[model samples]
Target: MAGKKEDEQQKQLEFEQDEVLTVLARSGDASAFNELVRRHRLKAFTWASRISKDPHLSEDIVQEALIRAFLNLNSLAHNHRFLGWFKSIVRNQALMKMRRGGLYRRELPATALQTASMHQASVQVDDINSIMDYLIARSSQAENDGTSKDPQVLLERREWYGIIRAFLRVLTPREKSIFESFFFQECSPQEIAQLFQISVGNVYKIISRSRQKVQEERLSFLIRAQIRQRREDGLLKQNVLDPVSLKESGGSLLTGTEQLYRFVKARHPQLSLSYVDGMLLGAFLLNIEKSSVDMSSTNMIDRNYLITNGMLNLGMRVRYVEAFDFEPPDPNLTTEGIALAQGSVDLGMPAMVWELIHSEFGLIYGYDDMKQQFYGLDTQSDEMVPYEQLGRLQTRSLFVLGFVGDHPISPSDSLWRWCQMISRHARGQDQTFSGFVNGLAAYDTWMDVIRQRAIEPLGHAYTINVLRQSRKHAMICLAELVSEWGEVKSESEINQTIFNLLNKAEEQYAIVHDRYVELALLFPVPSGGEPNEPANAARAIELIKHIKYAEQLGIEWIEQIAERLEEHASRAHVPAIVENPPRAYIM
Candidate 1:
């Protein structure tokens, strides 16, 4: 009886390992997926070598196959059949590589090449309706009754659709309308907003919420299915619950500054430092500053802009995944958020997590399952906080960053996009808050508050620090741009003039930043000190005048640069639409 019990336990253990790993992997648990890869890599490699016959080529085939498998892991109908599905991918990739090589060889002869080209040209194309009908037929067969007769197969076919439909049924009427309008009608967010009598951003919010609901429902379904399967297989006895824990061994794949440094190094190893700085400039990661009466105490100007736009401006194709908004953070979203973070790190990409502590952004590089901790870079230092602790702090933002394989846009085009972003931002056109100003007008608004002696010492100090840091980084980025594009002798004179204006503005902003720094030191952020005297208020008003003058000068230069670029475009016979600066706040 004892020996039989041991045998039963062994079977249960094996079942648990397979089912749990697959389920977790499907749910984007990186560690579980890594384990699955480790167990299957040797077999996959062996299969590829047998098909390719060339060891070097087989290695490439296997790697590509694995990457494709991981990318399309969700498409796998049956978790138990993963090995077979993966093997098929390997075989197909290897066969396609061999066929391409063979085709190239066959094309060597002029007669063969001519005959092949003629044959390709003569191939008939199917009409859209015919192609659609064929696809529907194929999909219906697969869903209703494919070759498989297994119970799991039937469960997947019948229950998966049913689960999705059930979730759709749970949506409110408004949500359903938005969903249908966006997905079925293929309407733009702006169009949907008009139809619904809402803002475009609201349309996005509704869609995002709907997607989150569907994702949560799917996860619940998968977990339930796995539990049922385990019971049916007799691997789990009645009333027995499988132990679910997220713990794995291994240090971070990339740590500290290495995450940012390595990404740049991978692309331009020879000039790694320059590339790293460029990324920093592009990402606005280097523009660390403080702000008050803005959204937060300290603000990174780049934070207001999309990192995707910034990277694109730097000539990188980036897919932006806005996990969730940070306002009104919810603890219930932690599981999905953690999975997203881990998945990004598993891909050798650091996820930017917001509100790590003190409303700051951090790069999450690693997690410790046993400790239930996440390792990240905070503003002050590298931090390792309990997962639960971090979750409770209400971090609702995440970014998965990766480089594109190739630059698809020209440098000139990228520069134009960057200019547009800058112009829009500088004009307060993108401000999200009422009564709060942004761009050049923000300086005037801030001055008005200071002139009224209504700003708190702490708030003034914070704003000063933020402005100082923003200007410093702006100077760095502008100087880098000059070094990059100004050396082109063929650049139009007007374009050259714009670059000179940018440099001048950078210098002017630096002086303004320095003045703010001096003021901040005079009226530093209060740390439980006596209240500021009335005499200091008079001094503050005088300082505001100097700041206002410097800011106006900077804005003038920026406006001039914009006009110069527009003039150059006009002369070059290119249509240019330059927007006048938006009106500033009444001060």
Candidate 2:
């Protein structure tokens, strides 16, 4: 008895599974086929109803589609694919029915505008006839103007018809009938009065009131559609920032800085890439997470604030909008961040954002609202990120920066601001997060890890590669500064002294760059180049020490340059730095 009960239970479970039913049906099991029909009948009907826009016609279509699906069931090889295959048959039958009836138009029935009015019980039979007459007249006009072929014009016409139909529902039945005759049936005022046993004056008055009511609803519909189209247009326009390569860049933040620099130069054509990098001190910024067991330490820092500060030094008005939470990011903040990012893109600036394509800094260059995706550039590739997934990626944080406009500063003043930023970073002032070491202290932390032979080889190699790229950029920046100020053609001793200091700084950065390049080669990225092996580790340590010494000397030279600029400002009775420099707006 127990064995019989188990068999019955097993049979019941198989009956409940679609794959099982599909396989049995394919094998000519009549009862199994009937069960499949019973389960999917209502869904098939609903799909057909939406397509055919007539319940009676949809019922016939679904019935025919089901018969065809059953006859062709044996041709379906995969049981799991049965549902999708069955639905396609239903869709095909619906479309074939529409085409046979001369009602097909761009995936919807051509008679869609009249379907609601004709089928709804609230609309009288005579009202349906009047609506048909009205539709005929409008269809003739649409064809004459070539609007019948335009989907947008057809869509708008359908919306207007729907608005008119809904307005009629709000009126008394008698009033609805009279209005339909006058407006849709094209009855004269005298004829309408005679047919309704009312005075011609009353008929005209009724027509006026009904027209006013429908007009209000029509206006509202038009306003709503206009706003929707504008928003969709804003999103769909492909506003990709000219692509920047991510080949050798290590840190996502520096990659973002590179893209933002392009945006800045677009507005101020006189600014060079190296100059902008120097102003941001992109090469000098560093943060090391001592407790982090992997390569994330290379990018670990107070990223958003540091970017804001860098842009401020360049005399650019900027805003930093960020939302951060633990795993399962807050939906409300995600929504707010997306809006702000879209707003920035709409303003003709590529938004510098975080974790767009991955858990890394990147740029949101374009968007597609219809597809609900954002076009972004990152280390992986140019990718389309679904809008809903922006803040829900690995980092569970949203950070966006919009560069508004330039504030215009003299070259000397900009250079001075750069010095102050470099000084702060070198002193580890920007290290805000706990368990992290930044600026000059980051070097010591990194060296200590190497000494202990506790290096995550790949991460260590990646860090070395990133630092290498940064110092190379630093060398170029220093050279640009010296060349820029050397062209000043000034006899002032202070001007000459600043130029000399910058030249010395450029040499020191060059040495730092060379040392880093050697280290990068000694510990290649991805494979990590055997950094843990004793001899290699010793060589890497020596290179790192030389890199630190050269960078320190470079920082000292910048300090002297800043001092000389201050002295010159004092002698010229000009302020060395703007006291109330523009503040970065955080949203």
Candidate 3:
């Protein structure tokens, strides 16, 4: 009893402190506002960092947000709600930075906060206050009525487990499995899709239907309880009880922002084309097609590396940011993700998100702060994910865009770098996997795996798909290079020889690509089926051997081309190598 009394006193003291700070800050006490900033700086920085993925920029955004909060302090109706209001400001600032391509005036007049009026800030504050009031009232009513038991909370209490078990009975077996996997086990839709041999779209549909069923039953129970209460109270007239709308109970807070990409383009004149074209251009500059596979995982490769390489290859700077090195139990992770995505959208650049619901690369293009929803496209589908939903994923990776400085390597120098990379790949140098070989040698290792049936059928199929896609892109790159360099009249002989070798290599890769496509169809990744009979498996092995032969031939041709280019470099007027080449952060 004594300890409980002490706890209450402590809480009261903290409340008083908060009230005092709030009042002082609102009355233009600069020191009080600075104190508030000091208290919330780390959290605000964390939120901004998650969104912008750039610590330097995140710091700028947080400072701007605090200044804005100070200027608009009068707009806040309640001092207790200061943190939430300030968080919203930080989110908005991050979004604005993203839309402006990270361009913001760092210096503000010292008196700017004091001089600014609260008129502009009142509108947003009023909106936030209204929503908060409604939610608070609803929560209070639920507590008073003894109907505040959340489904998850009930499940946690072993005595109340029966309640959840009974509610789950409404779902069919398949629906139950999907619901459990999605909500309980926390498996991503893509992982579930792979396990069940279904599409990601179907996974979502199933989860939705199950949730709707549960909600309908819940509504039915509530209606029956209300009717019984009215009957017991001797209220004969039906009008005595207000009608309840079923739609209200099942409605979601998730919503999408309108015209975000359009707004981005309008604001930034340099981005004349669609994001798709920009992504492709980045890919080409980085030579991503050449480094899309890891010999060990087969289907898995380091996407962060690819993005970084692409940006660097284009002479553009980049910053890699992550929410955490390892997963944390903090609830604020989702808020951070939403803010980060919103910031990227505001910048007019897409946030390249990793470990999405589909276990694939997702581009977050828009966000609705009011509804707390992020709109993005994955390899499987375009969808709107709730802000809270982002926290459930395993990994949260972000790629923050930076401006392109002067060309790090000239066109000719870039070509030379490409030659070196290709040679390294051909020789299987700098392999990421220790046990498994890489590049040309990876073909032999893969062939061995196929012959032994060591890899799963679905895994093999996915690998083949990656190979086919990468090879097709490689062919495009080769063709583009040939066309680009072919016009140079000075290096005609050498260029023709290089072009001929490239064409041959393209043909070789094309054949291998077509074979992989055929093999992938036989395995059928979406089916999640077992490999074919022994004869068919043997046939695949033979095809792998053929692929190996073709790849070896391509390697020989590349080596010869490298030799020819070197010889030409000796005779031709090659530009002297710069002593200090431009440097940019790679990852």
Candidate 4:
């Protein structure tokens, strides 16, 4: 009974004290405002740090959040809810940073809060220190075995700090503050309690939560690194590279920014962005992120390093980027993301890519060096499983229905309409053609790759998968024609065949679409759940919904086309044709 009474008294005193601070701060008292900032800045810093990941950037975010809060003091509804309001400011700042930077393109979405919260939990539960340790260990093991050269090993080792810094940025402001203080500030439970005028035990809880962010950062680093390394080492068995690289620099190993730039340009002619541009953007991202450290780079040498490697230009487009550029998170900032966003809104630059990443990942605002996790990397080079070939059995099935029509030879115009109309639409029913956008981004590469494909024929790529995928759709459409109107031997026949298929496919698609309107159901997810619930499972998740639809339609088309393929198959130089095929597809 005595302890309960004491608890009530303590709460009452804290409440009164909060009321005092609110009144003083609101009354235009600079001293009071400064005092408030002094008391909460660390927590704010931590929150900013978790969201932005870069200490210097996180610090800026903290300052900006405070400034905004102070300027908007008149809008405060309840004095006691000051903490919540402050948190709101930090959250907004972080989200803005992400939306502005293009770091968080988006991922498969579940319902709103549920999906967001789950993503946050994944970022928080992992340990930053442990993840860093694991990454370093991975480097050490690889070094010991001579699997990779010492420089490559060391690069990954050095990047561990970057990973930590990036991960810290992903944390929610509250979580970030807790983790920052626990790890960086070393504020004991007793000291924190006296400072907050709260129970020492509550402080401990906050500290524990902070520690968890560290763990998460570390784990994320290892996981991502492993995925990348596997692809590099040929474990993934895909394309060797995007053809954008320095010819294995023999002795010194391509360190010059100009040399690297030229090499990438030669391989991918239409692609352009310089290293300095990347740094400039990175600095902007970091400064606004401001979770903890000072944002000044006055002490660093090699100013040219940033300038020389910062930008790139391919043809008419100018691209600003960093070597390993990291994009900001989505409009919804994750725990370790950007802290603020300031940019032109016209390009819809802040639009979300709600179908890209796995559900477990959170969006971010800035950078966190110590945490070594980032909101997103600039270039993720991969030979994307061709758009036409990416879906599961069901996704392919839906696509088949979408393209096939009542008249067997008719090709689906719905597919053409989707591709043509969606590239420009913004919202509502206009977004129904979202599948094309998904397909475009799904090409498993950066903008640079697109340029490469544009300048050099797709035939230039070395991957057989690329070859097969590029023509699969054309073949499928051709097959649909044969199924409806029998075999054709001449060019005129083929042209007429294509025409008939296109005209009839629209009708067939509409008929089937009405019958199986449930296809769209595959895309919807339960709210508050990670959108890729199945992807996170031990086994492969279901395919992207539309991809499944395509496969269903394509399979039937392939069966029809395969008969004609036999005649050509008997031709003598299959290998020669594969190596130096005529420009048959494009023409």
Reference-based TM-score of each model: 0.45, 0.53, 0.43, 0.22
Worst 10 residues of 2 by lDDT: 578-587
Q: Model 3 over residues 1-587: C-alpha lDDT tens digits?
A: 99657545443433456567889878877656766775667668766664565667888898899889988999998998888798889987876676466632432211112212321221122122212222333344446867557653233333222344455678999888887676545488999999889999999999888865664444334434444554577643211111111011111110110122222232333432223122222111111112122222532233344344434333444343344323321233333344445544544455555554465445565565434456655545667765555534664332223222323545454455455445555575532422345566666666555554555656556656555555555555666666666676346787788778777866776676677677767766665345546776777778777876876776677677767777767524433322222111111
lDDT of each: 0.51, 0.67, 0.51, 0.34
What lDDT score is found at residue 350 in candidate 1? 49
What is the per-residue lDDT of model 1 for residues 1-587, given as tens digits with 9 covering 90 to 100? 99657545443433456557777778987656766775666567656554454556667887899888888889988888788788889877865666456233211211122233442332211111112222233344445766345564344334323333455665779997896676534488999999999999999899888765654554344334444554576541221111111111111111222344443333444433333333333211212111224224233233323444545544444332323333222222344455555545544444555555445555566665444556666444666755544433454443334343444555555555556556665566653332245565665555555544445556556555545554555555566666666776356775567667768876776677677676666666653111145566556656766866776676577667656666556424322322221111111
lDDT of 4 by residue, 358-427 (tens): 2111111122223322222112221222111111122111000000111111122222222222221211
**Candidate 3 Cα outliers beyond 4 Å, as residue runs:** 1-296, 323-326, 329-347, 355-358, 366-375, 379-409, 489-492, 521-532, 560-587
How many clashes (backbone N, Cα, C below 3 Å) per candidate?
Answer: 1, 0, 5, 126
TM-score of 3: 0.43
Clashing pairs in 2: none
Q: What RMSD, rounded to one decimal, does every model reach?
A: 24.0, 21.9, 22.8, 25.5
Clashing pairs in 3: 51-340, 98-346, 98-347, 99-346, 99-347
* 297-327 per-residue lDDT for model 2 (tens digits): 6555555555566676666776765555433
Ranking by lDDT: 2, 3, 1, 4
Descending-TM-score candidate ranking: 2, 1, 3, 4
